[model samples]
Target: MTPSYGVRERTAPAYGARWSRERVETAALRVLRWLTVAFFLVVTLVPFYYMVLLSFRSIQALLLAPGRLWPSLGELTASTYVDVLRSMDEGGQGFLLFMRNSAVLAVLTVIATLLVSIPGAYAVSRLRFSGRRQVHFLFLAVYLFPSIVLAIPLFVLLSLLGLRGSIYPLVVVYISQTVPVSIYMLRNYFETVPRSVEEAAAVDGASRLGVVWRVSIPLAMPAITATALYVFMIAWNEFLFALLFLTEDPANWTVSLGLARLSGSIEIPATVLMAGSVILTLPIVVLFFLAERMLTEGLTSGAEKG
Candidate 1:
């Protein structure tokens, strides 16, 4: 009554085939996921690492070994940072001046853009204004238009008015470029706020402006903060206008323009320029991470409500 050997062998082969297919599929998915994540990490992180790595070495090291990923401790140098930050009269790049100018211009642009865009967005969202639909179309059109195109007129006007090489005109230009998109972003977030809360505030004798300031502003703080961060980053990283407007006056040069101009010089080492770049990039990175948490929390809270 013993079973035949072929019978047992046939069943064993089928079972093994099933198990093999399952193992292969699982392994393929795991590999795909890891590959995707690795690609993202490399793309996002490699540039920052390179900036830091290059910043710590001299141009001789970089030129002699352009392919090196990490600098040896013996090659490490902090003199690049000092050389970049010190004043030109002291035989340095004078980037500290550019940093101050950029900070002033970016902060002023953020303040001006937020002041105008906040009210405009609220009006468009809450009021029964005529042409409300066309307003959004106009904002979208303005955003889509090339900054280079606007640069031509702005450049000409600033030159004619003796405002070229000054920070004032650059601030104006930054405000124009940022305000439209800020309005659009703030408008979407405003629309998401419950109308009932505003109505309740109105019942308590709050005026339209009061409702916006007292109720809407507090409720929409996260979105407002996110939009401010967005505008701040835009102003901070702006390069073309900064170059065109401020290149003639080293006193007015932004960090971006200064870095570009300094990097172009044959006498300046690439590592020193890289150090300047890291100095320029660090603030924006810190701000983005801080604001990212607030943005996600705001968006997730809205999503949960629905």
Candidate 2:
């Protein structure tokens, strides 16, 4: 039985309608994805490019041509960098000391956070202790709380102890801020490790701590590295606690606080401040690129199993 031509044509239009809709939707989504990528790229890269551009140009050039993207060869100078990095005694901004302070605080926070979090994470992941589940809630509570709220009590405690002007108090505050997240990251990775591996180590006369240190830790090194980097970045970039604790002591100022303080000075050049910003941003960029691969692997290690 053959269908009539008119009827066949009408059915053909109906059959193609669903496919046409799907094609339209798919193409729309593809275009939307590219637009999103381009938007974020501009949002993220443009500021850093501008910062670099301004860092190379003098204040006079920038003021005269505020919209210029590139500086002429005659206008480019490294004096801004020199002024930012040299000591105040040398008539510079003394950002070199700020960088040193930031590095010390970040490194110390990473170390201290890891020391507390690693064992705590292992215990939560591997042990069957009383109130183990509730511990995570405690961590979540701490992590969810605003830092500004926590800062008040911390500031008062430090002041009472006469520790307000030292870097050590800032390190302690950062440790509190970072340890909960560190424990969470490490715990997630540690749970993915097979218990059989630790049991095997134990069969060889290794103690519980020995199993954690020698067996489990070696396996979770990637996650541990990622967590350490995360903690370091947080501590390095933190401003509020640094401001509260170290603002009274110029010698103790971290790079973030120093750059902020520089902004308020009418005598300092904007180009020099921009150079200081570049210096402050450079280490984080370098560290991220260096550890990018390890970080990726660590973050995605257990995804396939789920």
Expressed as tens digits, the lDDT of each residue in 1-306 for candidate 1 is 223224432233658887666557667777788899999999999999999999989888888899989768898999999999998999999999989998999899999999999999898888897898898789889988998998898889888998889898788888889988788778778888999999999999999889999999898887888988888889999999998899989988889999999888999888888989999999999998988876555436436668
In order, candidate lDDTs are 0.87, 0.88
- Candidate 2 lDDT over 172-290, as tens digits, reads 78988998989888988898899999999999999999999999999999889999998888888888898899998898889999999889989999999999999999999888888
Provide the lowest-lDDT 10-residue window in model 1: 1-10
For each predicted model, how many residue pairs clash, with residues at least 3 apart or on different chains?
0, 0
Model 1 spans > 4 angstroms off: 1-23, 295-306
Give per-model TM-scores: 0.87, 0.89
Maximum-TM-score candidate: 2
- List candidate 2 segments past 4 Å from native: 1-14, 293-306
**Candidate 2 CA-lDDT value:** 0.88
Q: What lDDT score goes with residue 208 in model 2? A: 94
